[model samples]
Target: MSKKITLFAKIFSISFLFMGCGMAVFAQNKTEDENVIRCGVGLLSQSPTIFTKKTVSNVSVTASCSDTTVYQIPVVFHIIHNGEAVGIGTNIPDSRLTSQIRILNEDYRRKEGTNGYNTDSRGADARIQFVLASKDPQGKATSGIVRANGGQSEWQLSEQAALKDKSNWPKDKYLNVWVCNLKNGAENLLGFSSFPVNSDLDGLPTGADSTTDGVMVCYKYVGNSPLSTRYNLGRTLTHEIGHFLGLIHIWGDGFDCTSTDYCNDTPAASQANYNCNTTYDSCPDAQGSDMTANYLDYTYDACMNIFTQDQVARMRTVLCGSIRRKTLWSEYVPQEEPKSVSMSLYPNPVTNSNVIVAAVTDNADVTVFNAIGQKILQKTFTPTADKITINLPEYQLAEGCYFLKVVQPSQTKTFKVIVQY
Candidate 1:
């Protein structure tokens, strides 16, 4: 399947000033489990076919499908702290939390020039986007970030329910991410996520345990900040979210090449790679080398970069097939307030010419720009009754990525569009 690249809004610029701070140096004693074994190993003990059967079947059916639909998932960050004052201890500032969300969107969408961009041909734009929920579960206005004092200093992987119960929104409506101190026995764990458990072997409906259906991460590894150091760059959540979206470890959570992660593009490895070693391929018999750069690997945060094309298909299937996850993209659900106007552009990658159909509230201006932010076309149109169609000839645009900005009386929205011969 040819990956569909949908641009939303302008390119987000991420600052790397905090990257030079080095690994997180804490006063607590370190364990044999260094920075890489952060993700929980419990899920591996589940039905192995859970990741293989569902993912492989979905990928095969969608192999020739073009992902033109854009999925926007609402997220809620549950910040759990040890009764520390605001901006102190585990209660990280909202600025840091927001940066993490930005990283998720950029990495999943494959924004141009961002750290998420990979040169590998296997790299794909997932067409999945995340936005912080603007409304609470009760329909009250909120920033989507819930802060709570769990009364404890640290939370163990086994105590995920206790940490999540401290403050959790409806799991079906929002992607709940608990940020606090996470530990696996005596070792400090980075993060872990629960896979979408809404089906059985017979395709029967068997929902997952609601209390433990989200992601949990240590506060220090939450974002790309000075405190997060080595595991910074906000890839920890990206990796965990991959699990939330139904992606398993690239190594298939085994010590032998026989185990597979269900993706053909990723090479089999006997074990996970700890550091940024690109040349280390444990399974020589498999096609190609170990996909050390994949987000599903145990490689360092800075080294992990892309998701393979089949991985994208696997995730999209979970969103479309899961009972609860499927509701995230529902048109009936009320998204963020001050909702942007709805618009559509067809024959994307514009073969010869394209038609843009938009529901304009009033007089609006449409502007198109190339990948480098250069304006290529602009027009002012007053909708007859709330709709307008603009014809764009292929001769006017070179084959490349472009952005379409719509300026209306109430609000303005930007969409990424690709024009190709």
Candidate 2:
């Protein structure tokens, strides 16, 4: 319950895999006689198609380029609600909102967090970074989350019924997400998203129709509860953000699942579902699951929680290419602590299976990459007791120099790992 829900967030969910049956398709059920998206349960039952259907652009390169700079993004949460707003007035509590933002940054940057039921074994923290937006597009100071009272409406759509006008917000400087009680048809709408309908008018993709654009959550489901409210997971915002960045659902709309959401690498599925059955191979002939772990899938919040490497590539392209998302990185100034800045690998002139990681925080996540940056060894904690031993006996990492990175929330440390195997 942070701030306003944009039309983009509301409608965008319609395009996700699980519920290809979205607002636009289900809008017929609303009293307003507006467009509504249909809601279908299982997406895995679909067929398969060629992987590379749509390209990001002619310059949309996949592998890491010569440019080593990382992209940082700023985010502003607009929490719209009808109840006595929580999170101490800034909409949802700052702690929860910050937690959500941190989760976004982590997911975008490929960090890890508490696992969900459907999370993939592969831990992919998106390489980008995110922070609360301190400045709006118009250059105004902001709390990052806004609050508006929509009266007794439970669904975000009901609140939208109160204020249907688009002038209520500043669309460009801020990505608006309205949270309210929304009922589309058979199942209550979780959230929705869309790009700018009039990109030329504002030069920013605007999301309106909060009833259909932003997230719709029941009041009881809005907090940081473990899993009580499966639909309110912040990952919903993650999925919508995927759409905002131009990635599409793995499954295509209609009965045809192979249509392609335009992103290469995501396998085609005939339909999307909320069930978190890893064995539920919808498109068995395809290379992988429709990426049900992807934040964009329709599985329950606890069931759906992972972004694939290919998905990360697509998101990175969006950040670097179209959204000017690099601007968001303008704020995060990493601390100057050298230990926080880089990690150290001991026994440089060595000849053994065990290597020591010195002077690092306890329980730090570590990754060892080859000269080309391919990760070979990844572990959660580099034990704290004595000299932390890393057994590199398997990689047959040649007698050469490699990179070792130690990471944790808010910081990353890297150093050289000279091997003699």
Candidate 3:
């Protein structure tokens, strides 16, 4: 009698064997002893042929400004697990998720009191903040955290799409982050992120694939907890988010020093530094030492501290230049009671010049504040015949996020404006 074959069983056996070998290699590497950041950005650039295209093609470099523009990004965390209750096993508690968000904002903004904040002159407050989305994609109120029973104890890189599909919010409006127990076989594989594939290098539409858009993080590395010794500060997500915002490895994703990360500031290096050794310089031709403290490197979480000024500019360019990312922050117009006066600013996101047009019954005071709430410019305007135009020169103000407040006799109205040089 001819032997019958079960195709499904045979395939499962082969897959299990492959997984076993992968695990063996990972275990032998002693990844925990030496810090390793298994970011999938380099892997994504290799396959599918499309991701390899240069990210900044037609995008022109904006003049670096003393003040960095502040961008508010809405974030949602998707927790995937088997049947474990909240706060058990891979089903992390809400506090842990919230703590991760806190760490991200502190690192990006360079909050004064945090250990992540650096006093070095190169240290920069990215002026970027992350907040839990108050509204869901369906327009319903939400806590910004989605929980799904994936029915799987662990997941691999190949299963990212399956895990994300379990629960995904709109990528354009909110940054979706998935937290789950990654496959133990790939012990060093901490996390990965999909680059902004919504547009091509030339700023043309590439029809970004929604399924593979956001970020995937291992549950153990998601938060700053006592159990997570080396990576307890939650810098892994910070590093992955750097990729999400168009930052490559400080070594330029190559094994040689000839490669460049496209930023003028970051020094050239042949490889990533794993530990907190600040004196290691891999490139002889470079101007400065290796930037192991940079968030884009594979340094230990406690060692990572700053993002250079050039890096801040690069990220802001992606935020405002990329078609999908540019619209992340919707214009918020504050409502007010009916008034006889009307005030407005034209050429918003003003580059070279700006004019404030106002139709008012009386004189008013206008004040401008930087993103950090420091008053930058203030002037009182007296309208002629209920209308007047005021010209704002670009030389006086630096490129960044600002707020304009107009004080009238009846009430005070404030408007948000972006200045790009």
Stretches off by above 4 angstroms in model 3 are 1-37, 46-69, 198-208, 330-421
User: Alpha carbon lDDT of residue 77, candidate 2?
Assistant: 55
Query: Which has the better lDDT: candidate 1, or candidate 2?
Result: 1
Worst 10 residues of 1 by lDDT: 5-14
* Top-scoring candidate (TM-score): 1
TM-scores for all candidates: the values are: 0.67, 0.55, 0.66
Which residue runs of candidate 1 sit more than 4 Å off their true CA positions? 1-36, 41-66, 199-207, 330-421
Error of 2 at 173 (Å): 3.1
Ranking by TM-score: 1, 3, 2
For candidate 3, the 10 contiguous residues with the lowest summed lDDT are 1-10
Better of 1 and 3 by lDDT: 1
The sequence of per-residue lDDT tens digits that candidate 3 reaches over residues 74-115 is: 889999988899989888888888899999988988888985
lDDT of each: 0.72, 0.51, 0.70
In candidate 2, where is summed lDDT lowest over 10 consecutive residues? 38-47
